[model samples]
Every structure is written in C-alpha cells, then in structure tokens.
Target: MGNINKDNLLYMAKYSAFNPYRMREREMGYTTSIGSSDALAKSLYCGMKAIATWDSDREKAPPTGGIFNLEFSPEGTLLVAACEKKSIQIFDPLTHERIHAVNGAHTDCVNCVKFLDARMFATCSDDTTIALWDVRNLKKKIRTLLGHSKWVKNIEFSVKDKLLVTSGLDGSIYTWDINSYTEYNLVYQRVFHTSSLMRCRLSPDARQMVLCTTGGLIVIIHDLNLATLAQDLHGFKPNLYRLMQMSHQMIPVAAMYDHLFDSKNRENRVEFVSDFPEGNDAEVVSALQVHPQGWSALSRNISHDDKSEWTCIHDIQPMESPCDKDTRDTSPVGRGRRTPSRRTRPRVYRVPRPMHPNPMATTHIQITRESERAAAGPSTSHQGGAPISPPQPSRLGLPGIQNDVWEAAITIKQHRLLQEMYNRGADVPSTSGYTPHQESPYTSDEEPAAKHFIRQNKNRLLYYIEETNEGKGFIKELCYSSDGRIVCSPFGRGMRLLALNSDCGELSGVAQDLSQPRLMVELGQSLGIHTDLVVSSKFSPRYHMLVTGCLEGKIVWYQPFSGESL
Candidate 1:
C-alpha cells in the first residue's frame, strides 16, 4: 500500500500468502490457468521459506561421549554440558570454541549439570553423589554431598533461598543449605515418589516445584516457604481460620511437618496433581521443564518403538475456589435428619483405667543438736540450751546425715536467690552453667510475615506434538525459551520448536483452534557431522542463539531468526 522498499519486499516474501515468485510471474502476465495446484504450491513455498535454518561452520568438537544435558550460566557468559563419559565440557557460545574440558569429573557418568550462579555450578552422577565446582578454579573439587543411596538424576538450585534440591533414583529428594560451600548441611529429605524420580524443576520465582517420576506421576509443590504461604493467606477466606488455628498449635510435630512440606504443614502444600492413567497408551515422561511464565513442557514416549515421542505444553490455571474440603462438618446444622448410631445407647468417652495405685509418700526428719546450730551464724540460740558450738566448716568433719541435710538447705537457698534475682531483672546465669552457642551461618533468619497468600493455578495441557519423520528419536531433553513463547526439543540430528499460542497473556484461553500452529525445525546443513542423535539442547536466555550437543560429541549453535549456523 505504501512505497515498497527492500525490507518490505523481504517481509512480503516470508509472510504473505502470495508467493513472491508467483506475484512476479503474474506481473509478467503469466496465465493463472497453468494448473489448479498453484495456490497450494504457493502456500507450501511460503511455509518452506519460514522454516529456520542454521549456519554449518560453527560446529565445535569435544572428546567423544553422549551429552546428557546442556545449561547456560545465569549471566550467559559460559555454556556447559554433562557427558556420559564422566566428563564435563565448557564452551564459549559466541565463538563455538571449547573453553575447558574436565576429564574424569566423576567416577561414573554425569547425568545432570546446573549453574548455581555466575561462577558456581553443580553436577550429579551415577556415583550417588553431587559435586560442586568453581569455574574460577576447576583444578580441585569444591565440595561433595553424599546422601542419596542411588544414582542422582537431577539437581536444581534456588537462588533466593540459597538451597540445592537433588533427586535420586532411590526415590528421595534432598534439600541442602548452600550458604557454606565447604560445609553444606542437609536441611530436608523426603521420599516424595515411590518410583525413580526422572526430573525436578524449580519455577522461575522459586516458589513452586514440579517433579516427574518414572512411574508416570507428576507432583507439584506450591509455597515452598512457610512465609510465602502465610503471606498468601492474608485475605483467603477458606484458609484464614485454619491457618490461625495452626499458628496457635505450633508444636514440635507441626514444625517437623512444616520442614517436610515447606508450608504451614497443610495437605494443600503438596498435591498429587496429575498422573498418566495405568493401562493407557501414554508413554513415560522422560523430561520436564517449567516455563518462566508458569507454563510447563513435558516429553513422553508415545509408542513402543521409541520412535514416537510427544512434547506437551500446559497452561497453569488457578481454581475459582479452594480444592480442600472444610475439616468441620456442617451437616448437623443443615435441614436434614441425623441417623442414630447402631448401639441402643450412646457410648460415653472415658480415660483408660490406671494399672496401679499411687505410691505412699515417705518423709524423713533430721534433728540437729543446739550446740552445733548456734555456731553456723550469729542468730540467737534457745534460752534453755547452752551456746551451740559453731557448725563445722568442713563437710569431712560432719556426720553423713547432717552433711546431706546441710547440702539440701544450701541448694534451696541458691534456688531462691536466683529466682529473686530473675524477678528483679538481674543477670541470672543458666542453671546448666554453659555458655550459649553461636548460631550457625546455614540457619535461616526468621522469615517476614507474608502479606498475602500465594495462589497457584492447576496446569492444563494445551497441545501435544507426536513424533513425525523429522522429529524421530527418544526425546533426551526439553527446554523453554526465556520469554516462554517457544519450547524446543532435540530429536535425532534436528531440533523441533513449538510456538505456544501466547497472543493472550495466559495460554489456557487459546487451547481451541490450535490447528496448524507455528512450528520450526532446524536441521544443520552438515551431511554427516550430526548423524548421531542429539542428546541435549538449550536456548540462551540472553541471546537469540540455540545450542545443541549430540551423542557423537558434536556441538552446534544456531541463530533462530536467520536459521544461520553460528
């Protein structure tokens, strides 16, 4: 409609339904009756041009092994990969050059790797331990956490709480206090799943956690901090009275529950949110990830041949009302007749009978001679008795009974003196007579009272992509883009990108009419360079590049917009 420039021409070529070639042919007076398939051909050509491509010259080679996982540092300065040969490789994303390779990083295969901060990262291995490393000095190990009895599968770091959450094949999830790198403490441990835990993901806010088990179970935990729950319940009518009552009965058992559940110890904290039904054809989930915008992506095998894998995107929807039922029964106050008990008469509640009668009290009296009492102090003696000799100064000179009586009297006097001093605001030391110990650095300070209750919606599955010819392989990993607009998974030598319908802020509303959604597949131009299956892939949070590593120890970086190999 306006003056066409080079940029407009290129845009029209890529996006317009009319093919640029067809338009040019039409301008040249080419006949439209050449074939009825012209319109379909034009659409196909447009779709082909829209597929992203990559440059082939940016491939990097590392010592050979399958790359299990890829992660970018929070600052996006370094890229790291966990390998199956007990090694870790670091690369520079911009140059596609190998930076450092830590050979023999673990005794067994390194299953997962995650960046804790800019300079720190953690790795889990089949050796049943998690090792922390410092990028600044990789010559020596930073620390090793030993607790899981089986192979560790996943590791996640909570930056806000300075905690490390690790899941193992033993079905246990362990939380560690990472405040002290050299001396980390196990803060909490629980058997969260019956089967082996496949993966664990912490939400962007670090307030929720999602875990997937090999048994096709998914568990979602909300309000990871009691303070967060306390704040969220500020105006929640249903939970207000319950939480208030819980605060009053904050006994040792309740504290234990809080530590285990990470909330007010209520049943709502941990939810058995969803699970693939038994006897269904759904495949076991192999990888799971939570988007920054509260959505989630999971990859599951759909067929027995292991060739068909599906990646499902889900939108989290909050319930209109609380899912929990009120603990109090209001039926008695409603307009309904109550049924009588089976017994003819109501049974009275009573305490259990005692086993035995109480023991009789025993009293002992001690009599001191008048001569011995007058000497202990300057108090007046009885008028009829002679002046008593001063009490012996040493216990060795007194009788056994007299010594015992005198010691009891002295102890009673000290107790009275201490109590009086305490009442008078004096500095009364502890009866145990031990100096107070300093608080440990790993201990958390009292969390501030939450101003409002944090509410989370249930996640709803939006759409799923089954295996196609271009996306055939066992899905090794799934990742979400920083903006939550796209989810990418590497299959075989190529990667599939699924664009979520996020025109609206929430994804749940766009569940319908998802037919023919945008999808992009990037297969490198190198003929045999990436013949092996891609084991790991990740999108840079700060850049437009996507990095992938394959089983043959080849790494490829791609620029999504131009599909140019970086």
Candidate 2:
C-alpha cells in the first residue's frame, strides 16, 4: 500500500511528453511514487473494495479474456461492473462479502452500466441492446432500449436526466426521451458514418450535444425547442408559449472580435482609444474610441488603397506603447468555445488592435514642438496689448489647439494604475523566461515543475490545463475539496485517496490498493479533518456503506469507519 495524490499521477500523464522521466515511470506501472505515510493511509483508506482495468497483456501472447469496464455509483457506495466472465456479481465492497449474483445477463459479455437515478440502473451489452433494471427489485425489468441494429457500445443520460443517448457498432446515435418510451418517438437520431460512434456527451446546460466518431469526425447537433419555433413561425403560442417549438439555425461568420476593459483609469496623459474595424484597406477604419469628445478617434489623412493616387483622410500624434495581457484582453471566463445563443453567459473580452507608428516622423506633432510657440509662443494678452495672468494648466494634459487634437480615451491616470499593479506583482506570468513550459496536456511532457508553472497561494497550487485524452479518463476524474482537506484521484484504471497534511502543506504517505487500482472511480466529501469516499466494485450504484466494484463485475458493501466488512 502506498499513498499519493491522484493529481500528481494525472499530472504525470498530462506532462508525460515534456517530462520523460516521470512518464517513463508511469508507463512502468509505478504506483504510489510519492512514498507511503501512515497519516495518508488513515486519511484515505475509508474502506476496501474491488477494482479492475484492461488486462495489461490483453492483445499480447497470453490473452486473458477478463474484465474491461468498471465504475462506481455517484454516491461512491456500490460498484457496477461488466466483465468478460459474462456475469454480474454483488458483494460487500470492504469485506468482499458475496451478496448476490446475476449470471448470464447477456449472451456474450456486458459492456457498461450507468445509474439512471438512485434506484434504477441501466446496462449495455454486446448483444446490441440496453436493459433498464430496478436494482432494488433485481428480478424485474423496467425496459429495454433496442434502437442499435448492432452491438451497443456506450450510453449516457442527459444533464436534466430526461433523455438517454446511446451509440454503438451500427455507426448511429439515438436519443430517447425516457418518459415517452415509444420506439419511433425518438427525440433525435442521426447516422454519422459507416463507422461507430465511439463516444458522446451532453453539454452541462443540455442545450447542445457532441459526438466523437470512429471516423475521426466530431459532430455537433443543435437541438431546437418545438414550442419556440411554433411561436416564431405562426405566433399561436403567446407569452413564451412557442419556446418549445423553435429551431436553431446555425450561421457561419467570417470574422469575430471581442474586447474587455476596466472602467477605472489612473494615467493622466496616455490612454487606449478604440479598435480597428473590418474591411478592405480602402474603407478600413484605422481608429476607434471610448471618449465622449471624439479626441481619441483616428481618421487617416490619406487613403492608401490607391497607391498611385493617395488621399489623406486625417492624422494625429503618437505616444508610448500600450499594455498587453492575453487573459485580460482575449480569453473568456470559461475555456469552452462560444456560440451565438442569447441564453449563454455574458462575458467581457478585449478586441485587440495594432498600435500607431511613431508620430514623431509625422509633421503634425513635429511642427508644434519647433513652432514659434516653442520660443515666445503666445502670452495672455488683453485688447490693450497688456500682458494678463495665464490660468494654470488643466489637470489633463490636453493641449489647446485651434483646429483639433487626438488624445487617448484612457486617461494618464488609468495607465499609471495598471503599471503600478504590474510592478506590485498583482498579475504575473508563471514562467519568467523563454522556456516552453507544459501549458497543454497533449504537450510532450508531464506538468511543468510546480515552481515553474503553478501559482502558489499559501498552501495550495492552482492551475488548469487541457487534455487530449478521450472522456474523463485517468486524470480527468479527479477533484479536490474547497478546503484542500481531501483528494480524489479517480482514474479510468483505478481511484486513490489521500489526506492533506495541513501543517506541513504536504501529502501523508499511507495508501490502500485494490486488485485493479486503475479501474476505480473516486469521489470525496469533507466534514472536518476527515474526508470520506466510497469505492465500489463493477457498476453497482447502490451502497449502504463502503461498497466496491471490480472490472470483473463484482461489487461489495461494508462499513469502513467501523472496520467492519459487512
């Protein structure tokens, strides 16, 4: 038994390309690289349970027809399993007590299992159908989904839990409104290709769905509410009556831009004005503005579209360069790609534009600097030619010009405030130099050393990186409690738990190992210094206590706190 944070393990997979050493260790099946400590064991070892992964030598010389799919329920109590044994088994997760068994549920092998709710569960099989069952009344069958003409490969419930989608060997995806069990009454179904749909998922909001096909094409489907379409089409439904009938039309845009800005300004002299608009050079708007006086707008003096016959539209003076930070400038709140849905969350994004060239080279500012005003200039004189008192300069450095003048929309004060924050380490880049740190999971390295890439906040290291791996695999399943008191590393192969050593800001060294540590799915909750998790064997979602599931289709339930294998 060894203890280690699951994040560290997933980190290894994420940065495997960059950090060859750590990845090599992972490939060599090195579990518990962080070393074992008693404190970690006591904290993480809530109970014992069965677990499983793909047989290491599945396609090798010695082929063992064993278990493949393994999962635990949302409550982490019961484990549900589909194994090569062609049977589903139930047992005490901690004590390994054999509770019940369903021998030969399918002609071939069981593929996967999912909990519909707390009491109902669903299982798919190589037999090409999904069977819904009432787990509490195991002898009865709730329903059987039979749309797939071939073996069903996967199934998932919608976010709202009203719809269930399934894909399989037939290269088609089918969605069913569970409440309306009619076969032809399918809500949505599409034949993607001759190849199978390997996986699919509904978005968190249930507005859209995505599909990953074996043919390598990612298909996106837009679902429309019939009521909304009816209202827009005929106006029969009033007061939001047509929302349920509306259809979404996808339109392609050639270009898009976003800009975000803080309302506060600290710089007095220099400021940001506006962004350039889209168009040919002939009609391109070179300047933009946020000012009321129109002093920040830029109008080109000459049109460059006709090289032979140049025309001046307008011109102005130039100043220092502007600040550039991608996070504050370009990126949205969530990393997800945005769509044109009005219901989507509103965000502030900055539209980027090129800075002006040196206005010193221009004759406008050059003339003012060397004009007679540079010498005697003009004095405050009355009609009698008698010198009068000159008023103090305006707080803003706007010069008095007879014709017109262009100034930054951002005041000098705003620019100065941003600079102050930059100098004070308010927003700093993680890496200082040109080193290409691991910013992506697909990069050829494990996560970069925490010191080089992560932001340290007192006792915690926080960062988010993307992964190229398919559906919530090894690293994707892990999550931490807000207080950092518990760690759940639910890998596709297995799950691990670790205790947070609050005093040392390090992980304790004790751990518990199941048969297939890689197949365990983990989740945790914290009450105090203790965070509890339930591990189950196979696909059993029901757990009265500490339950476990094995990839071989076995499950167990026990009382981990009392050390009783019930």
Candidate 3:
C-alpha cells in the first residue's frame, strides 16, 4: 500500500510540472487576454502595410531602438529627441508642426540632443565627438567638440552657462566651456562599467550629472555644479571615514514590485543600507543621486539646531542589497516593512551604550529575488530561498562585504554623534570644532536650484514628459501657469488649454486637432514677452521662434499661441 501511494504521488508530480517553454508562456500569460502575444502578433500582421509605410515616422517608433534619451524645457514647451537615427529634430507641439531638422548630422546615429539656448544646440554621435549645431541656420555645424575616443552618448548644459557636459561610450564624461571653445580642466572620467555608457544628464541645477551605462549601471559625477567647491578638489577624495560614518541608519523606505511570493502579485521587500560612500554629505545635496557606483544621499545640517546637527533627509532608489542565501520570510513581509530572517553579530552595528540603554544599533538588511538574473554574476541572499545569480563584486581592490559591514558601524557612530549634539546646547563643545559659517560659505539663492523638490503648498508645477501611449506613438507635454492661473496640456490627438484657476473656468479654449503634441516650452518673461512656444518633436530651436526643418529641407513655424487668430 505504501509503495503504491509513493508511485501515485510521483506520477502526479510529473504530470503537474510544465516544460520550460510552457512555463514561460504561463508566467507571461502569452495568450490569456486581448493584448496577449497572440493578439500582438495578429495586430502586427494586420498592420504590416501601415507599419512598413510609416516606419520612418520618427514620432512613432517602436521599442527596437529603445528610449535612448529625452529632454523637455523648464517651461515644457521645447522638446528634443535623439534616437537611433543620425539626425536631430524639433517641432511645435500644439500645432503638430515639424520645426527644425538637421540631417546627416553625424557619421553614426545621434545619441543625445540638448538646446544650449535659442540659437545653439549640442548633439553627441557614435563617431566619437559632439557636434554643436547652429539650429538657427541648419545648413552648417557651429563647432565640433572633439575629445571622446568612443561614441559620444549624451550632453547637457550647466546652470551658470559656464560648462557643457558630454558622456560617451568610452565610459568617460568631459566638461567643456562654451567661451573658450576648449575642454575644461574638469573631467568626470571614471570607468564605472565594462560596458559602454548609454545615457547621461545633468541635475536641473547642474550640480551633478548622472550616467546610465552598460551592465545596468549608473554613475553620479559628484561636484559637477560645485559652485564653491569646484575651486578646490581636482578629483574624488574617497574619504573612507565619511563612507564608514554613513553606512548605517540609511535604509530603503519605499516599496518596489516583487515578481514572486504573492500569486495575486503587487509585493516587494525593503532594502536598507547607509548611502553609498562616494564622498558626499547631505548638506550640499538634497536628494540621493542614483548612479552606477551606487546611490547618494545629502546630509545637510539643520539650521535650527544650534549644535549644527546633521539633519539631511534624502533617499535614493534601487539600492544594492544582496541578502544571505538563507533569508526568506515564511510569513509575508508587508509593504514597506520586512521580516528579517535572523540577526547576526557581524551584521549589527555596535553603538555607544551611553546613547541608548541597549546601545547596539540594529541595521535591517533585505534583498529581493529578481525575476531576471543580474548580469554581474552569482550573488547570495539571506532568504533560504531559490538560488539567484547576482553580479559578483570585482576582485580588483573594490570595497568587499567586510568593508560594507565596517562602514555600517561607522555610520551608526556618526548618527549617534549627531543625535548627541542635537541633544546638547548650541554652546556645547561638539559645536566647538565648527562655526556657523565655517565649513560652508554660501547664501541661499533667491531662485533655488532647478531640480525636483517637495512642494510645501502643492500648488506648484511638476514636469512629467514620459513616452506616451507606449511604443513612442506620441509624447505628452504639460505645463501649468506659475499660479495655476492657466493650464496647458497635449492630450491624445489634441492640445488642451484651460483656465485652471479662473473664476468661471470657462476661459476661451481651443483644441488643435492633431495626432499628438510632442513638446512644449515657455520662454518666460525672459523672452521679453508673456508668450509660450509649442513645437512638434521634430522641430529645432531657431532664433526667437520655433521652426520645423523637414525631410525636404522645408522650414515651417506653426503659430499656436496666437490668441488673436483663434
């Protein structure tokens, strides 16, 4: 009877399991719904002719080339797109008119396009140099930036109008000066990854530049906009003490999606650690800059704390937290919380007993199993879960697992020191080593840096211009007047302008019938008028107006903000 039961159990197990191909189909739900693979295949076959004919319509591109780079002006009016094509284009978004076009722009495909101002723009290409174009006159190139030995992938402008940033496939980024027409002494040339860099962008204020490279890595060029510090350091300080001082107390506070565990889906684990020790403090930084080496958090001292306690509160996304192989939760870990498998002595940071009764600072560590294996190699996790392949730490002198643990200890010490100082009065000895304006020497600017910030009133503007309708059919551009007095948006197939804060909300309206409004820009009163420019994705910035230079070398400037005409 026992043997028969065993045989029957084996038979059932064998019948229930699926092959690799079937498993993939089941996991992806290949043909389970209307938008399934089967449906996609049918749609592709049905629209074969349309797809072939409209394939060159750069406005509507498929994911084969991926989203190389995207940029929108602060006013959200001008949009620049650089893709696999060796050209740069701009457009009047509201009227759906192509504004400027530069063909044969590069020997290889243009990787990035950035507007330097109304007349000038910069583009990087696979041919190893950045081309500065006089978009005002699309007939000639203004200047050719030659330095990078590999494909120049991205370019950006600094806030002070002093520098031009360009990153290339060589894993190096160079900063150049417009006036000198020569390479600046500053170069954030770090070989962060074995693979080539794909994209790079400057922080709104241009303080730092972030690069996304091959191997799914990101690198943050610290002090790129060091208004004061730029006069000092030539390269990274690599302060081990500072890195150690910031390893603990920093933990992942947000929620991420998990592919496994919950059959109904929508679950993730919290990964917390001290910010990556790349020699940055919170005072000079306001947010965690995600990069290939790791993410960064700013540690600014609170003004109210007479003790000058460090009170910087910043966070970075996609932290690197590889857990031990034996660390899975039997019971589910709720959103934003984790049930750590077990606490070990080595992983815990020992704090001074004077600070707290127990004294040991407990650092919470959690690692989620990725659906796709990491490219770096096999890594371990704590959840006695399925074995996962994670990128291994480079054998070459990089910080090891032990170093991370030690750094965690130092982070706890720094936090405790800051907490103690906060408790003490401003006149205390801890504040003796520092003066009110000793270390930092700068006044708060009237116009804060150009970057994302949490608005206290919530009545402010937020710029969001992601690829819309998926597969790049169109891009949505939005801009709300400073006081929300007016709102303009390019919705599906039309441009919508409304009186958001008007009393009657019946302010004159118009909808330009179009497939999509790809870009929007407001020159502000800086343009000497209270008018805005809306251009298509293919248009380029020229003179004071937005003009479209099409494939036939035709220039067309669509007038959408002409209220009198409407």
Which predicted model would earn the best lDDT? 1
lDDT of 1 by residue, 1-566 (tens): 56556644454344334444766765898665422232332232223211222222343433546677889998778988888778888878777667787988998778888888889999998677788899999987787776665567789877667778887655455666666433243333342433334567777777777766433345666656623433332222211222222222112221223232233444325543332212223324557888776655454434322345556654433333333222212231112322222223322211111112112100000111210111232121121223223233232222222332343345445545644453354554666663223232322322111112222223344556554424332336767666555556665575665554312122443445554322222312222336567667787878756677776666766653323332
> Cα lDDT for residue 409, model 1?
45
> Of models 2 and 3, which has the larger lDDT?
3
Indicate the TM-score of model 2: 0.35
Give the Å error, residue 249, model 1.
34
Candidate that scores best on TM-score: 1
- In candidate 2, which residue ranges exceed 4 Å CA deviation? 1-42, 45-65, 71-78, 91-96, 159-161, 169-171, 183-188, 191-196, 202-566
C-alpha positional error of residue 255 in candidate 3 after TM-score superposition, expressed in Å: 29
Give candidate 3 regions above 4 Å deviation: 1-80, 182-199, 208-566
Residue-level lDDT of model 2, residues 1-566, one tens digit each, is 13466654554444332334654766888774343222233333444332322222332322212333444555654555564445554433444444555666666566666676766777777566677776687764576555554446567676554767676544445555667544332233332322223444444344434443211123233342222322222211110111100111110110010111111221111112111111112211111111111111112111122221111111111222244232121322112333212223322211112223233222111112111111121221112222222223233322122101111112223434544444343553445643233243322322122111111001001111111221111102232322233343322234344333321122212112211111112223222111112112222223323323333222223222433222
- Angstrom error at residue 388, model 1: 69
**Candidate 1 wrongly placed segments (more than 4 Å):** 1-62, 181-188, 191-193, 226-268, 273-280, 301-307, 322-459, 468-475, 501-529, 561-566
TM-score of 3: 0.35
Superposed on all Cα atoms, model 3 deviates from the true structure by an RMSD in Å of: 24.6
- Show the lowest summed lDDT stretch of 10 residues, model 2: 249-258
